[model samples]
Target: MLFSFSLPFFLSLFSAAQQGPAAAPARVQPSAKIEWRPDRPLTWEDFRSRPATDQLAALTSSSIDAKVGCVDYVFSAQVRAVFVPTESWVRDPKRATPQLLRHEQVHFDLTEVHARLLRQKLSLVKLDCEKLQPAFNNITKMAFLTWQREEARYDQETNHGLNLPRQQAWEQQTQQRLQQLEAFALK
Candidate 1:
């Protein structure tokens, strides 16, 4: 069970953040950010309030805490999705149902989708110590922009999960997208 940082209610622009700045720009321990798993869909119980974000509904961001490194000309890095229970509260516990959960999940799903794309792109990249950070930053920047754009499109197309038909459509679209990027899912 986990609450998340993906907010459709508010549209914030994320660049190579990118990683979220809503929370303080503290250094995140790799262990702190949970990696998104194909088997897991967020549940309401996961939305605990202790580490709350400033009253937002959902937030989806990635921590490529892994800096690009090359040993013997081989490049490697670690990238994962980190879900923090910020900006989550059941408006009506009774009404805070799967319908809404699905919407929130989409927010995180969108983030994971970008993460996959990042992984795919990063996999092919060759790194040299001198050029590593800039190249990595470029990948991060592109992924982050795509993430923000997709978030907006999701909210507009689905009406923040208010329109069931549109919501369903988004679900199908995202699921298909996930399938297309399955090869890049983190191990």
Candidate 2:
């Protein structure tokens, strides 16, 4: 008998200024989704959502999407890092300085970092079909938790881009890690 199964796991990381929540913004149709590309950096135009009436400077909605499958005895997975511009917002164009945008870019890059990390961990999977589901769940769940912590740590350390030195340090660190994991990155 031949057996095969595939499942997808999605983990989203919301990066925003630390502040109390306000009234929800209106919903609008997303124009086009942006996937992570080293050559392509984000711009103010990429933030399409209506800014909330709060102290938030911006919000970035990024996620890791993974699909793992087992066919017969072989296992495979596909992973991607994605950015939703329509869901991301900036409070004001005048305040959308280059530094702030760089901080937000790091948020997206961090999502890609975790995606690569998950891909790296998943690459080590070697199990029978019966063990695939449970193992995959455990790995992905742990990765998601770790990702959350990293995001929080980043915001805390950089103070939402207010700390220029820390933010620059994080930018360099993030770039280094991304390059280190380039082997696991999606083509």
Candidate 3:
């Protein structure tokens, strides 16, 4: 995602003082990111590398950015998903078990869901450059709020994917929702 996140960095942003016009914030470190893959589910092996010894667990994040243009009466926006491994990381390898991997996988899957939703909406509605930014912003805001709420609910409902029955429910729900939005799935 064009958005940057790391437990420490995100947390630090909260603690650090606001920057004034004269104070440009320090540069953020680059994170190693992977694109969301439909064929491959995450595995424990994927959590091997830890960028920093931050006092927190992993955080999965996604975002959408689109380019809009028009020709005569036709309007089009190409929406895409951005996943960043830079901000996403494992706090402790030992704690990264199969269940944890599944939890992380769900986060990525939710991202794909938003991407598909955006695609479906774009296909049905036309927005020229004049109306592009606001339209894209509105959609992105909705997707982001949904992603945040669902992620929290997933953790709460499943106890961070620790509860077997609850975790399965979230998994099935995510799968079903993905299927419902299959028409706009990524290529």
Q: Which candidate has the top score in TM-score?
A: 2
lDDT of 3 by residue, 1-187 (tens): 1222221111100011212122112233356444556765654334434545453455554555455556674576566665554555555445455556566777777767776776787787665556766766676666667656766777778866667799788888989988998778766
Give candidate 2's error at residue 104 in angstroms: 0.4
Which pairs of residues collide in candidate 2? none
Candidate 1 Cα lDDT to native = 0.58
Q: Per-residue lDDT of 1-187 in model 1, one digit per residue for the tens?
A: 1111222222321111012122212343433444467876666554544323434443333333334567776677666654654434333333344566677777777777777787788787765656776666667777776777778888777767767899898888888998999998777
Q: Is candidate 1 or 3 superior in TM-score?
A: 1
User: Tens-digit lDDT track for model 2 on 82-158?
Assistant: 77877788776554567777788898898889889988887786756767777777787888888888888898888
Q: Rank the candidates by lDDT, best first.
A: 2, 1, 3
Global lDDT of each model? Answer: 0.58, 0.73, 0.57
List the candidate 3 regions with Cα displacement exceeding 4 Å.
Answer: 1-32, 44-55, 71-73
Worst 10 residues of 3 by lDDT: 7-16
TM-scores for candidates 1 onward, in order: 0.72, 0.81, 0.71
Which ranges in model 1 have alpha carbons more than 4 Å from their true place?
Answer: 1-32, 50-67, 86-88
The number of the candidate with the highest lDDT is: 2
